[model samples]
Target: MNSSLLLSLAITGGLVLAAIVAYNTWTLRRNEPKKAQPPDPSAPSAPSAFGAAGMDPLLDPILRQEPSLDGDLAGSAGASPLEGLDRGQDPHDHAIDPSDALRMPAPAHMAERRPGLDPLIDVIATLTMEGVVSGDAALAAFPPTRRAGSKPFAIEGLNDATLTWETPAPGQRYRSFQAGVQLANRMGALNEIEFSEFVMKTQAFADAINAAPDFPDMLQEVARARELDQFAGDHDAQLLFVLRARQAAWSPGYLLQNAARVGFVAGSMPGRLVLPASTPGMPPVLTLGYDTQAALADDPEQSAIRDISLSLDVPQVHRSEQAFARLRDVGAALAQAMDGVLCDQNGQPLPAMAMDPIAADLELLYDQLDARDLSAGSVLARRLFS
Candidate 1:
């Protein structure tokens, strides 16, 4: 009996100890943070990648609230004369302040140059002007083409990959959509020519701030961008031109007569476009530069997902080389400053400025531009240059 009692006691003790350990483990687990659950696939809605809708950067003075289209985008609603006119000033509503034009938008005005006109002119002029100065008559050989705006310029098979949305892990999948833009690194080298030109114009041995040592050299670039826009028939001309201007742009302050302007892009010129305030890590033109398209494939749930097909023309800078990686993303310094946001979403990304907009209203505006016929000298052109 004594032996049996001792055995039973031992067995009971062992069971009790195991029960304590098991209970403690259960308690600890119950108090621990629950594993992060995946987002329910059937949720009614999710916040936008930008976290909101109906956002606007600059409101029209009159309309007060509408999609803020870049003024120069042909059919932008509530847009001003310069809607799409950042790099180039609309000579129409914007009378080139005779003083501004005469003085030149060199380094002195650099500090004051906000988003419009100066950088655009500076970069494009930089890119094309040198050829003109060196007497590359081929650029001037452009036959007079009628008024054309916002046409698709063939990229000669840039072959940006098509993108599709991933149903699983949509957040990570969406992040990968940047591949198309990343692939556009091929254009970076093309911009080096522009920067070289910027350095020449700003640093050239011109005696005066505004003087273009090569007279028509600067103007030739504008003509080319315009011609490219007219003939090529896509936003690529404008976009590439902007990229070149922003990235390649440099001011020598080379040998200005004004001591203050000596190291400046000439006292007459403005310094540079300040990057807009960081809104969720986007620069202003990032939104402008990116075009959002629908995911190539539809979700069975029709999860209302879209892919943003963004092609960035980057020059080498920082580790940004890892992203686009063609050459140093040329104007990465400038791009570093731009902040972008998705202020709103259409059911589809078609007609998204830069992408396509699916919204009926936005689409109509896009259609108007698509159907728009610029008869060589359109109203906007005639009013300005004429």
Candidate 2:
């Protein structure tokens, strides 16, 4: 054989062997089943911050941040810096979560649960004397005359106190206390004068009964009261509209249900409806009901109905227009519901045109108060009014 022919044959044989090996490897891989890759042990697992309900609404915003781009947060730090901090914190810690701050503690007075008294007693001045007296006595037995707007007062016996005692059977024997008065509670200054008169009148009663009486210096209290009253009158002067049942009387149950529909809750007094107070012990901005009696009786099932009145504490609200408008609307609804007529202090019926002037006046008054930096129904207003 020639040398070149032999070399070509050897090369051809080598190429055939290589092709056979490649074919065999392909067939083996095709026949075998594919196996899944095991999870990487090096990757960290994410901790779930919520239950089956999924992410909390408050946390959704924070979690929505995308960390993919440039390996940086999408925005500034979100949520509280101490979102996942342990709740058992030190008492002196300054860092309070916003959500936790929302939950306010109850007031000291409410925690003590002081017994409630007749709201009339709170609003009115009261004078009491313990001795043998009659419950059925007339107002003539008292000094101050009963009038309207300017000077109004009431006289009743201490029969209510006798009933307060735990021991029974002592109807009028040992509990022979007499003479209680409900003086007007409009303002501190006016009440000062009313209270002084009350003190003097009680002195006369003591003289008549040959009894010694304890009295304080009237001049100082009166002066202080006058100052307080002046501050209140300048800031807390209120405008109100009265609604009375025109033909038939309004039931207490009906009144409460209707008032509640308009967002008026049970007030401090029986016959009163009030919006939420600005702060604890502060008077509500809006109040409604009758003057002489409570809005509702202690026992609604066995109580008689009387005339209903609605009033608004103007200074107690930030927006006088909104407050006045809401009151007017609510009053109109109540009047219509109870088959009553809206009126002024007198029996004269109120027209729709009447509210316009009142609204304007409220705006002016609100501006005045705001200018003086003593917004009505604010902490300052409440302090002065108080």
Candidate 3:
């Protein structure tokens, strides 16, 4: 061949080889699993579910970069950076001056003013009294067991002084009374038998107080209970993420040590730890649990723990807390620290793709709950879900 023709052939071969290499690289990339990027600690969090209500943003938990397990674990694994910072005077230890106490206005009324009976979730019974009754009298007339079968039974009084409904308490006078039985709970919808039992309890209380008891139509209430129960069952979400050890099984102490670095504290129960809610007295944001047997063993350090679970009870936590987001962040952090992988209850690896759909679904569920005036983390939603 001529030199020019040979050169032309070599150029064509080179072009074809370059095209093949590019195609292979594209194929490899396309087939590789997509990794989820860890959330940027400095970035503003997603808008809260309660943002529409203009709730205080300060209520949200402070965000910090999750520490890597590769660091010195023994030095300060779980300690907060703000630990040494001055927090002003301790409220408990500070003595209140008598003049300051006198200057403080008395509360307008007792804080427990809201009535116990929520018609939306309870089957209510109105009790009309001929005259005012003492709270002591009402309390005496209360049912022996504060339950109608599996449902909670409660009685509230219209305070003669405050004109607000409240649970009957001594030294107060009530112009009228109301009783309620929960319509449904996790146990199931209220049935005719439970309704009958509720009526019996309310009627007896009314007789003892010499009041006229008016109960709702049993059939209609039962139907409403079933519908409410169905909605709750469909919307309820209790998410759980399992973390499996990648290689060597972790001891209970090892798991606790790593989990603590991510803000987990010992729970009330054995083999359990919790990420407490930002608000005091609210249910915990997340629960971390492992083998109870391992926790209870005399030598817990020797116990081999292959897997642990992180759980979030949706309705119990306010959406403003960004609990689900925290669950993901904490799970990722712990997985990195403990050399573990996040999985589902069935031990299947949980990928970012799988979780994205869940987040979307949760938003929809929150909307549905809000539409029904049972927004997640509200008193009504908590009661209904329970």
Candidate 4:
């Protein structure tokens, strides 16, 4: 039992214990799954940021696109640039992509164009003059001067400074005579009957003024114009949903910060947020704005958000139903999350029942538009609707 012998024994026992612990640890680690390493910062990320077909806004391309007008404007006929829907194609064959619908179209100049005058103009002129007047007789008429609240129509060479279509002085003699139908008025397109009356009046004036006596069938022209006007009426709607916090006033900073998480970006207008379209230059399908004066307060750091609103521009968007549904869901979610009231533009609360009629109307309009080869939110539709 010497002290040196005892010390050696203790050291050996300690070494044996350490070896056992190390071996157990190695075995446990080998059997267990390895912990995942942190992702490589420089490596490309999975495509989770965007949805299938690049629908998500987060993955929107940096090279933003405006609605393409090339094919429509250039008259590249045959297959339609709009996939799934053509003049003769089944309208319900495809779903309008949400992302695509949200994108704003180029300004009218950027898209397909029709001549200012209707095709029937030349025909009317030729028949009236019996080939004496050039087929380009519409050119003789001053282009309809569009005055706010005034129904302007092309007057073929009627140069009387005092004459408005509303009151063409009867028996007034002029070097040139009024001809053709009044195409459109300030309110909407003229129906067939209106055009017929216009034709009669113009013809009478032609006779009184010793102008050409021939008349052209304006029924077809009137029908086409009526359809165009009807389309415009159906699509010119603007629907709005409002949210007002039930608790404390909203923090603008927090609201703006979280809004981006849900896909809204700073809008062009101050105190507004916009859901931009997939096409870069097209107008946004959805816009949200604040009602509180704080929104426009000079202070850039103002955090008060007393009221918020969500709006859908019907004509500008492709699928009204989808847009409406998405808008409703998003508005409801935000309202619930923030303890707010969900209401319509009139401040009346909206229940599930309220949306049903709206949805039905949307479907009906969509069907009508489709039947006419004017799909909602398409370039041609947009132009005609506008």
TM-score-best of 3 and 4? 3
**Best candidate, lDDT:** 3
lDDT per residue as tens, model 1, 191-213: 33443343343333222222232
Best by TM-score: 3
The TM-score that candidate 4 achieves is 0.47
Off by over 4 Å in 2: 1-235, 277-282, 291-302
Q: After superposition, which runs of candidate 3 have C-alpha atoms over 4 Å from their true positions?
A: 1-115
- Which rank order by TM-score, best down to worst? 3, 4, 2, 1
The residue ranges of model 1 lying beyond 4 angstroms of the native Cα positions read: 27-33, 39-43, 46-113, 116-386
Candidate 4 residue-wise lDDT, 70-171, digit = tens = 111111112211211221122223212122232233222222224332342222332133223222333333333322122234344432443322213344
- Model 2 over residues 107-191: C-alpha lDDT tens digits? 2211111222222222232334455444324222445454322333333333454454221123432232233223212323445
RMSD to truth, every model: 25.0, 28.9, 18.9, 18.2
Question: Which should have the higher lDDT, number 1 or number 2?
Answer: 2
* Overall lDDT per candidate, in order of appearance: 0.23, 0.44, 0.69, 0.49
TM-score of each: 0.19, 0.39, 0.71, 0.47
CA displacement after TM-score superposition, residue 3 of candidate 1 (Å): 3.0
lDDT of 3 by residue, 214-283 (tens): 9889999999999988777666556667888887677776776566556666665677777767666667
lDDT of 3: 0.69
Instruction: For residue 356, give model 1's deviation from the true position in Å.
Output: 42
lDDT of 3 at 352: 76
